[model samples]
Target: MKSLPRLILDIAEQLPEGEVLRSGRFLHLGSRSAVQRALARLVVEQKLFRVDRGFYVAAVDGRFGRRSPAPTRVVRSLANALGEMIVEHGAHSANKLGLSTQIPVRCIFLSTGRSRELHIGKKVVSIRHAPKWLMALGETGAGDAVRALESLGPLWAADAVPKLHERLPEGEWSALVRARGTYPSWIWNAIQAHMGG
Candidate 1:
């Protein structure tokens, strides 16, 4: 049988750049501790870049040596690996939907999985656990709009409602209406106003 290190390398090479590696994937090759050690050794050799405690990415050569994968990509990879529902936090959602002008210094996300922070190169991505009602919207534009409005609060509803009414697709408005009962009173009122209910 190929040694643990050799087997790990073989598997990594087949994966494209920015693909995340977790020790659990190679546990069959050795004990849990041994697999972790082998993965750590690979990182030490500069063959992999550890994005977080248990997440790693291929160290592909770039213009200035090897570059860590983009923060968004790493988080997406992490979400998939953990089979968790992850979505951009309200501030990011507001900014993306053109409802807010400010961009947060650090990118944040709401996740159904355990809360954690990841450093992807210079930028930081935060994944925080949120209420199931908030996450029920899933990772769609409408969901983002709902979270954004919730974060912006009731004060902004007068103006935000019209902007959202224009930006959100008809289907999203319907989805928002369907989920109205789950939202806070303020948000639900705004949704009501927007839908003319």
Candidate 2:
């Protein structure tokens, strides 16, 4: 029979790019220590990239040679694996929605999961834990609007609401309106005042 490390390498080679491999998944193949050592050996051999504690991903070979998967792909795969709700940061959302002219300098995401930094190759991506209400609409445009408003705060959001109402699709606008009940009083009041409630 093939050794555990060899078995792991075989498995990793067959996985899709950006697919996350949890250490727990290998428990059935060997003891915890054996699996840990096997994973570490693979990392040293440059066969796998360790993304976070207990998480690993196979390196992809492109024209530039071997490299970790794209940060966005890794993040998306990781979020799906963890069953966490992850969305663009409010600043990014604000910029995308034309509520702000400044662009975020770093790759930042808001998540229902704990705040953590993911280092995929040389690039570092930040994931911050956000309030549930901010993620209520998921990845939709209406959700972006809500996050943009939150990033802008009460004063600016109040001013931006009219534009949002005008710019957003009718369905997205209605979705935003319907979700106002979950927002804080300041945000809800701003929406109510500017949107004519």
Candidate 3:
């Protein structure tokens, strides 16, 4: 059997620089202790950096020298690793939709799977549990509109009519209109009022 360090190095070579490595992935190669020790040694040697408990990413050399991967990439890898469905949070959606001027200090993602916090370098990323109605939006442009409208709240959802009409595809708009009962009464009312229903 190959030594744990050798096996780990072999695995690392196959992964892109920003990809996250969890100790659980190496169990097939060696005992858990051996896998963890090898990872710890790599961290000490500056070959890998621990992003969170049992989570590491290869240090990629750049113009300044070894640098950590971007937080967004790391988070995406984390979502894939955890087998979670993740989407942009309402605050981010609102900002993207031009409904808000302030940017969130911590990048937040809504997850239908698990809620947890991750640290990528100095940045903190939050995966918050989202309700089914919101998670139903998925990654569609309509999802962005839903999240943006949600963030704006019932009091302000009415203001999003013009923007929603401009950005939402005709089919998605029709879908939202047809499924108005699934959303908050105010949201349904706003759509209904605009559609002259």
Model 2: per-residue lDDT, tens digit, 46-75? Answer: 778888899998889899899888777888
Candidate 3 residue 39 Cα shift, in angstroms, is 1.7
Tens digits of per-residue lDDT, candidate 1, 40-122, equal 89878877777778787766678998766667777777888889988888988898889999997778889998888876655
lDDT measured at residue 36 in model 3 versus the true structure, 0 to 100: 88
lDDT of 3 at 166: 74
Task: Tell me the TM-score of each prediction against the true structure.
Answer: 0.86, 0.86, 0.84
Which stretches in model 3 have alpha-carbon errors above 4 Å?
1-3, 6-10, 44-46, 51-54
Residue-wise lDDT of candidate 3 within 9-84, one digit each (tens)?
7787688767888889889887888788999898777777777778888777799987767767777787787787
Winner on lDDT between 1 and 2 is: 2
Q: Give the local distance difference test score of model 2.
A: 0.88
Clashes of each: 0, 0, 0
- The C-alpha lDDT values of all candidates are 0.81, 0.88, 0.78
